[model samples]
Target: MTRALILFAHGARAATWAAPFERLRELTQARVPGVPVSLAFLELMEPRLPERVAELAAQGVTAVTVVPVFLGQGGHLLRDLPLIVEQLRLDHPGMAISVSGAVGEDPSVLAAMTDFCVAQL
Candidate 1:
């Protein structure tokens, strides 16, 4: 299957917040050479989830793994994401989609946050 990564970020009203996401996407794409990576916002931003998904489909992506770039399981992750996934599933029943857990829950991520916090203190 042609697999791709979809980084799901909670959108910010401040335009500057998007820079980090684009940077992260660039880094991730570099690390995973062949697979295409795209960013989708939950709110307050353009190219929302559906649009991003559509773009992926246009690229002939057979499977997409959605990684939520969140700190915790909050409303957007807990509730909204699933709804969007369901909508996509219905819209493209044949497409294979995998929803990965929040990246913040990863052990390495926690460790990195701790390291940053300690450095700040």
Candidate 2:
């Protein structure tokens, strides 16, 4: 089964808000050439989670892992995301969809950020 990775982010009204996420997507896609990678936003952006997943499903992706590109376990991640995932589950019963912890909360990420913070001093 074909597998894909989706980097999920909270979109903003500003177009520039997506640039970072797009760059992240590109970086991840380069690292994992075997599995396709894409980005989807929670709101105020194109290709919302469902649409992106549906497109992937149409392209024959059997499994997908969603990694929230957020800093903390905010309402979007804790509340909104689960509801969206549940809908996706119901919408695509055959697909295996799973979610991982927020990127900002990851140990490695936090370490990097901490180093960056120290450097700024």
The TM-score of candidate 1 is 0.96
Q: Candidate 2 residues 69-109, lDDT tens each?
A: 99999899999999999999999999999999999999999
Residue-by-residue lDDT tens digits, candidate 1, 17-37: 999889999999999999998
Maximum-lDDT candidate:
2
lDDT of each: 0.91, 0.96
Note the residue pairs that clash in candidate 1: none
How good is model 2 by TM-score?
0.97
**TM-score to native of every candidate shown:** 0.96, 0.97
Error of 2 at 107 (Å): 0.9
For each candidate in turn, give its C-alpha RMSD to the true structure in angstroms: 0.9, 0.7
C-alpha-based local distance difference test score of model 2: 0.96
